[model samples]
Target: MAGRTEGADLKSVSPNQPGKDYSRYFQPPSLKEAKKRGKADVQVHYDFAIPEEMAGIGRGKHFLIRTYGCQMNEHDSETMAGILREMGFAQTDDEREADIILFNTCAIRENAEDKVFGELGHMKSLKRDNPHLILGVCGCMSQEEAVVNKILAKYQHVDLIFGTHNIHRLPVLLRDAMYSKEMVVEVWSKEGDIIENMPKLREGSIKAWVNIMYGCDKFCTYCIVPYTRGKERSRRPQDVIAEVRELARLGYKEITLLGQNVNAYGKDLEGGSYGFGDLLDEIRKIDIPRVRFTTSHPRDFDDRLIEVLAKGGNLVEHIHLPVQSGSTEILKKMARKYTREQYLELVRKIKAAIPHVVLSTDIIVGFPGETEEQFQETLSLVEEVGYDSAYTFIYSPREGTPAAAMEDNVPLEVKKERLQRLMDLQNRISLEKNLALQGQVLEVLVEGESKTNPDVLSGRTRTNKLVHFVGDKSLIGKFVEVRVTEAKTWTLRGEIAAKVEV
Candidate 1:
């Protein structure tokens, strides 16, 4: 710890580099400032070129980013990787070989943060062995005041800490951390601007994630996203469409338009009446084989979006509409802004528009003050909806959220029992749905080899069902027809019915 601050006041100057704004590094995330949705317009920057002085700073370095969170975080990691590569840093899967290691973290749950902290403790020896190695923490977790302060006090070896808003400033931050003895921390508390023309090193060529918007306005009481992510601001529709078109041209088979709440896209656009449905209507005409968007709020599932989705073509029939709770009373407590009947009505509308739709949702089992009757209401709703699948969780209290202050009346054993029941019910429903697909031929975009078996291949259908089949290595990126021969609770085993010649 003493070695960390040995030259804290000294700043090593890089050759030919101008002085930087050191005060910017002093800013840390503030929950109070993040909560405000001011009238200031979100500035859009079309130009995001890398600084010339730091262009080759990473010429002899390698980086490894351990990401934890949702698809949004995964996509953010891609952008950061692209930036690092542009600065001449190569990516490595092993931490031992990395000169700079970054933990792109998540703050949605306590367990996730615990896992990251455990890893940070494990990295202490590595930092001690290689004193020159730089360790950083970024992403949603870095956007919290408590999280940043905790790292400062406990993890003195961590040299860099930034947030989701200022990812475009990676080069500058990296340079500062590399040169300075003091820990560099820069996290924006307010909503960030929309940065265009940012580079990305996607995980794969077959499937991609394109972010259409940022932030969420629907402040669900149990959620910390609205604070960590800031106010909802969307990218220009033209920029989004252009990205999709370019992806299609690059032979990408699928793209999932990402957002904290995708349904409310384009609502923050100035002087424009366009909405998510309008954007979808445009992307549907692109040459991409499949298009999807996620993590929708049921309150924003408007009729226009349903009608456009019904047009089919590249718009896949799988919709991940998150209904956090089935009981209206619990939902009200969670501030979901919709009743049980309202959610069912929205589901009915979506089904009416697209009859073959495979519906999936999110459910929280034991929230604060939840009664058994309310839990039963959730079970009945699940039965009525006949959902293909669902992501269920026992409610985890997020710090700084409204629900965190509420009395956690639900006991630990009861919460676990309720979660078990919910998972059991959902697993049965999922198996039944998969059984119905047995002997039916479905179109699957072959992703890659199965993790467990090298001889077998893995892919997903139009409805986003994982199907494992034995195939040639060459079929990894092509769309093929597979007939389901066996069905399990979570996946489908199939044999190739036919192959599309590329």
Candidate 2:
């Protein structure tokens, strides 16, 4: 659920403010408290007051959404796009050709926030040139109090603003902003409720994102997801299954079950008996060719879940189990409940259950108070796990987390050096792992042409390894067996073994 390590290493940068750092503020609803809250009131209908003036305002308008962030934000953009299209807006790639521009932002990192602000400033000129341009900012960043306040006080030109909880209300929000010709700021900072039947314009024809649950209950001291995204809430299992079935009917080849903490699905519900494993079993029975889920926390991973993955009819063998740190001390400070041994045990079970499983992970190199010995623990874990791929980064502190207050003892140079060393180890391991497939044939779902070269097409193996091969453009959405001829650290090169069937 919480993907990255939170909090700033105080030793790395000079503290500009003097106080207990609220940098990583997450308020996870305790399971006890959730029990007392009782049945969540589900709001089924939105009061649609169509602004009279907006009737023809966007009659021939075209809009493009430049989404920046995780799968949650991507799915949110899909709903936003669907809502815009419902209001007679056509999609476009060129920002200059569009009447409306929306930025679906992320606030997990300071760099992310800075990029969004930079884009907003760039869009201001576009607004100045074409005064009718409707600029909106939504998503995690907008949910921040400071971000919203800055937008209200300085960037008054921002026509529309909303947060994660109220995406379904976009049509009305946009209409009101257009009609009033004034700033519209609406952001809710609290655990949110689920709104089902929200429309989505899925980005891919073959692959789709199906949200089985929402929010995170893990209040890792340095994380802000629990606050910004809200409490953990699972969609009705039937709703999720039906959505996947419909996607299959529409000829979708792949479905990724999206969630903040997918492993925690159904824990907040009435029975608490129907968990992620049960839901996976139901979905696996569906006719879809490929099924995958992301971002599982190691703590929630159990034998039942591992067994479900091992059963492996439709479930892809690729698991993105994020091990934020390897040191027990760092893990404790970050509030990751699992120890190094616990994580390795889980990994062993998963691999033992599902052979040839391609494992990927997220690793934070530097946390507050990390020492040479602690850093070695991370490196040793990487060596032991032999992760197929890893996303490694130096620690970045967010506002409102306990780690932000702790002195950052690891120097930036040390962080960089450690990160580089970690990456080097991962690269060697990745190359070694990929080399094992050099002589084998892998089933790869063709995504599209390779970004680096048009002569090649790229797709992913069932284990979620990227495979590039020479293939016809017509084979874009089909699954083909690619014979591995070369192996790179990050990708595999191959040729089509045979003509793709269907």
Candidate 3:
């Protein structure tokens, strides 16, 4: 909304000040130390205010964000983009064409971190060529001490680096970086307070990602989320409901309530006075066409939550409950706080309540001491649940988590083999599940043309299944009924059954 067009002027002026000496901020973090920090209670609720004066400093400039991570990171990039846009920095799709480039990174997987660094390496020439190209990195990866150290030691060209907790301070950080010659590093170590009322440039026209909460309390040994993201803190109920209502009024059809552990919402404030189920009940009243939530922990999921799903309205019939492992022993090792039997029981209860519900899960194939029998237990669980789909992975130890210290004695070849076997079994199950939907009408929120074929429109079922069907491009953003004509392992093919008016 600036009068003067941004991204038109570059090579104006440059002021490089060596960033302030914050060496301690880059020191490697220990899992034990991180655990203690998590235990040390601090304020979870506070008002967040961004620096207003620097809002227009980026007028006549452009910035590009290369986000690497999951949906949370993608959403974080949206917030960052909105912040940059507010500062009059137009977003440039081309990295080399931008005045400033920011990377919103993830630390969940070591490979993800490596990929980020690889990109940084690739962008070194860009920074060298464009001295004014303010390179910034933030998000879960920036929260890691090792990652920070690596960046400071080698990637000195990065102008700014901040963490997940301090996104509200981006404009201030950018101002500091713009004036300074050194890298601006400000990563918070504590469970930072909640930030509400941040502007976001969402990706989809019909669907949006709403962060109902931040961080995770579940210290699954294999996961670095608890350490990187801090603890579970839910957004205020009214704030969440307001977002849903606004999205509905804006004609958005679907809203996914995102959180590291969504089922644990509201446990932080008022000693759990109101829970996630109640929150969903209120959101349902907002009357969005479809509502869904992810990454629910079995330990936090209760009978009440299941009951709400049973009496569904706008809430979708799909749940992405991450059962990290199917083996009870592995579950204990991961500190998931729920046994396999308990998880199965929860699934059973869910199915009883919502009989038509489709389930998807996360599974880790290899662990420190997983034996053949234990691996079999995982396979058995897959068969028992008959999951619609699963995001299966071979365990990859993250440096600062408890699992990293564990002896990775599982042979690499064996781990790969186990992973393949698991996928092979799951593929059959997925194909079988999809085949069962043949000729059945599924309500799909038409997203857009399919990636492979433009003549065919693509969308997702309420159960979160991807379906591609032949239709006009104008069908995008509207819900339509598609009868499954062909079922593949991963996607469904169909012709347009009819249009649905919500």
Candidate 4:
């Protein structure tokens, strides 16, 4: 069920690669030229012929990758891990025990970059102790020009720096880094290519992440994703279905279809021959038990998808639709392409279609020019929506985003206060939502033990409510029906359902 590739191989058995560390090509990435790489209508043809073997260049070396940000980054880490495994590198959790440490970073927030730098600083002493250690930084953060310059100037200990594009060239890059005297930095911001056949290592047995598409087209003013991730490119619908089929064959019960804007899938290819709705319909035919998707854009979300969800058997009763703000002015300013009224209408339609559907969203407390009136509008929207849950954060401007250039008149104190107020509202709403579910029997897929109590197992219902119940360790990666005994803001306490009907 694996997707086939269309790229021609550029064959060359290098003198020193994979195992041997002889540098033939090692050069730093030019951040200056990367700005123009993600323009619309750019055709990105992938290079699929990764060397079947890398001449054992990474043999006897230890490698570790710490990933940050969204599911895209998490999936990228899996791909990178696969590449590392192919290169003969052993995995390690401890950086002190590893010969190579890679930070698969995120650039969504300023704090994320700060955390990365702080870790890089900690690794400087480690690098000083073991000069042979190959420290690298990849993923979204490395795509930033300023971040890379800071790494090159201040954090010289970093040995490799590649981007979202050209991860298939990791073997080539790794071989170069092994023997080269200079740091290897090649961050390509090209419109991302559809790379199939990269070996993937997923964490969970029951749940898996299948990327339906890559990159983003919506240049939301406050977002750096379009720049860091590149233009929207969907994996062919057949290819996506094939992967899902494979996962189903392997006993995976659930899969969260991964994408920056999932509902925007298939718009870029073959003149809209197939779309996210069509893809979901095809996926539903597959034998998987549960299907879910995330980070959907409200503008692209249409009646077709809602209709499909309404007719669901395998599709879960949960949707994470991110309404970044509630003010029409804010939405317009953010270039979200959907008005607050439009968003609320969409929500209404979805709820009408599926009465038990649980809705979650992401909300930013304070944007650059947001006034108290606009903020109040946001609060009103929250109350109106009565969201099942929400991820609320104070606005943080990304450097290259359009919002960054605007005057951030909203004080930090004000932003923090708004954020707290938002959280307080959302928490109360969440508790109310869960409280309504109390005493109901829910079918929970046991993912793992509860973080707070090992004796209890933790899993989520099809409605995506987290339920913790007393269970054995053997129940992990299995499904069970639990009766809700208690309800809280974030999670529920439940027990094995009795034979008696509710």
Candidate 5:
């Protein structure tokens, strides 16, 4: 339901005072050493144990969670769901029908925060009708000092607040909020500590999210991920592999290795025995039918990793390599170390090795001091790459990031125009790409029914292209061959080629 909206402009809601930029503290390690020494020392803390008496407090209650933001937050919601269910809480879809409601939020952009605030306001009437109803907020938004202060001062109805680091303590936090009759606020504002063996309730039966690593060390000047997600920490390789093996045992067909920068996995551990490539090789050996990982940094993407992806049969062919800018000048201002030539070369190498691989990318239309030429360079790059899809946006300055302090020279109207142009180009390319698949059969992993039309089932191709076809509900979670009948800019219309043997 959180699909891209049309002609959305990034607006600044909250502004901060001028100060020495803290963005340098979260800078990505040098390219030469990132694969070797980029990993930070992780101090695992398991001391915040939940009390036994409060374990079954939710025995007669039902709760529901609405997650916003990136995949990382969704995975966190899954963990929270698992925790609540463990304490005897039943899941509900309608917030009014439930005794508790949790909003797992995102603070990447100001609009995200605005949406969360609006939802909280809407839930206020619900709280009035059912005074016993518990309302809570968590995730990256809670990590912000400004967000916490505003919530404490104005949104007195908010029952509980936690941050990215303290999710493992949610059970206890909820219990305290309920009993104390006081607002509960606990957020750690520092590089975080890792907590392992946390509960998780996955949303899908065939697909599972396995966090191979946590946090981001790359502090892009316009981004807030490094601050919200703590310092980077890779999970032990054996632990990750073991988790995947269990998922395979549970009959899961797909596994998405999650992280702030997934490709940087294992750089923080000692002895340098394993890296992301090593983990990919290990996971490929497992019996999971599909393996994918997000958000590889172009600065850390190397030859060895590309080779591994090419070699690994289980690793999917779609790669979401984000090249936020095209001009070297703009990239440097953005603190994206790689140049446009270097990014293109990497793309060339990837395509050379894996000829059928479809490529996707992230692009920001306007930065602090972007010029028309630089914007044109981005347009040229988009044309050159012929991307299968793109996530394009007009830049919004996040408070505390270095770019926020710089003069935003690009006019709002210009930013919107550039974003529209970029989207138009991408849509044309996407349609052309999808057209090539017409009359061809693609292996699609059936996810569920299409939201727009339930009579049609939907899934995705290995290239991560969405496809919709008329099929029985029994086909859900199974891989089926769909012959493309029509091609749209965003999705494919298809028909079942044959009945799946399974």
Candidate 6:
């Protein structure tokens, strides 16, 4: 019962409590409470309006948001930005110029945490220079007690601290930090009710992130997302369909439905009859050019979903199914709930249904008890799958996870060696996969100018492969056919063949 922590034993706190004594009104993160799964009904709220008193509080002020980690965090930042914009706060990229600064953090890895702390230390000088400036930390990191405790002890200049459940209340938290002498802390330990109609200041018109659901319930042993994100809850299908229709009407070229475990959508609803497949089947008929979903759990990926994706028009051919390990024993230790054979069988089904499907995956090396033979199995699996790309990482324990308590017998050098081997295999497979596309024509949705070379424009094919070519800047948001001339390990060099009619 991972991520089922409804009615968790949280510290009682009054809403919008403001003061120095954070413990009085804050429900800080607790692993014990987070593991509890009560039968509380998941709540849904349609109204989410900014507080009347704080409506104009951000007038004549500029804010900056530094986002880290997954696409969900990026979308959360967009919602926060939309709220701030409603309060009349403009956005700034320069740290020195911003009157308000917020760090939207991630807690998936220790390295990400270190980078955030390093940036916070640098921000100390900025805070001292402008004493009136308000600084905040939100997202998954703030949902952890240890992280919040460390911030309180080390980064006292931080004015506000909130968590994932209560982002819609940012106006109140920001206002309290501005007026109160002490830090304002208001974090909910339980899963939040669904809040719809929140404004989003998306990064680009070409691509957008639409969150169809929130939280995870699978509770993988090596992960902290279950606790930090709370239990599984989904937005109503009508709400989701309406949002997609609106995005289509607005001329958005692509919309990726996001979730911690996207394939588990609609399970926590009242009747629980509908699911992600049914939703996708409905979304595929929309006028939008392209649609995608991410971070799927293999256990929840069933035949219905695969069938819907097969009759694809707007549903892209790319699937990012994360197989954390290739060893059945390792997956058991990680609580992935699926065996190696089952995963391969799922891949087989997908390949049979969609002939030209471009598959990608996530792999982790050096789990606490992983052996050399287990590592080799991963390499063999990578070669067998022939994934177009893979995200590989060395295993690092997070404090509150069950895996952290296990004996970490694998040494650092061993972990690094294993990771390198995994990457090498995946890289070779990627190059081979891309090289097959040499001279093949692809429809690329032009995102924008290439980050490295402005003279060249960059885009992604429907399968989510990156392609770069020399093109007019005006083609930023349109789809065009490109002839792939050269293929590298990770990217493709291409030339525009024809402009696509919208």
Report per-prediction Cα RMSD to one decimal.
4.9, 6.9, 5.7, 6.1, 7.4, 3.5
User: Which numbered prediction scores highest in TM-score against the true structure?
Assistant: 6
Task: Encode model 6's per-residue lDDT on 1-502: one tens digit a residue.
Answer: 0011234443322223334344433344455766686578877788889899988888899999999999999999999999999998999998888999999999999999999999999989999999998998999998887787677767888888888988998897787778777767667777678889888888978788999988888888889998889888889999999999999999999999999999999898878889999999999999999999998999999999999999989999999999989999999999999999999999999999999999999999999999999988888888888889999999989987889999999999999999988888888888989999999999999998999999999999999999999999999999989999999999999999999987
User: Ten-residue segment with the worst summed lDDT in candidate 2?
Assistant: 1-10
**Ten-residue stretch with the least lDDT total in model 3:** 1-10
Q: How many residue pairs clash in all the candidates, one count each?
A: 0, 14, 7, 8, 2, 0
Tens digit of per-residue lDDT, candidate 4, span 1-502: 0000113222222322235322212212232333344435535444455475574667888789999999989999988887888777878898888988889999888898899999999998999999999898988887776777667667777888888877787888777777777677676545456778787777767889999888877888888888778778888777788889999999998999999999999888888867888888888888888999987999999899999899888888899999989899999999999999999999999999999888899998789999999999999999998899998888888876778889999999999988888889999999999999899998888889888888888998898999999987877777789999999999999998732111
- Predicted candidate 3: what Cα RMSD to the true structure? 5.7
User: Across residues 67-151, which tens digit of lDDT does each residue of candidate 2 receive?
Assistant: 9989988988998887777677899999899888999998777888899899898888889988988898988887666676566
* Poorest lDDT segment (10 consecutive residues) of candidate 1: 1-10
Model 6: lowest-lDDT 10 consecutive positions: 1-10
Instruction: Give the TM-scores of the predictions, in the order they appear.
Output: 0.94, 0.90, 0.93, 0.90, 0.91, 0.95
Query: What is candidate 4's TM-score against the reference?
Result: 0.90
Off by over 4 Å in 3: 1-23, 26-28, 37-52
Candidate 5 lDDT, tens digit per residue, 1-502? 0001123331211113234232221222122222232234677654644568767888889999999998899999999998888787888998877887999999899999999999988988899998888899989888776676666656768887777877887887787767756666666544456777777888979889998888887878888887777678888887788889999999998889999898788878887657898889888989888899998899888777888999858899999999998899999998888899999999999999898988999999889899999999999998998899999988987776788889998999999999998898899999999999999999899999999998999998888989999999999999999999999999999999975443
In the range 53-107, model 1's lDDT, one tens digit per residue, is 8898888889999999999999999999999999999999988889999999999
In candidate 6, the residue pairs with backbone N, CA or C atoms under 3 Å apart (3 or more residues apart, or in different chains) clash, namely none
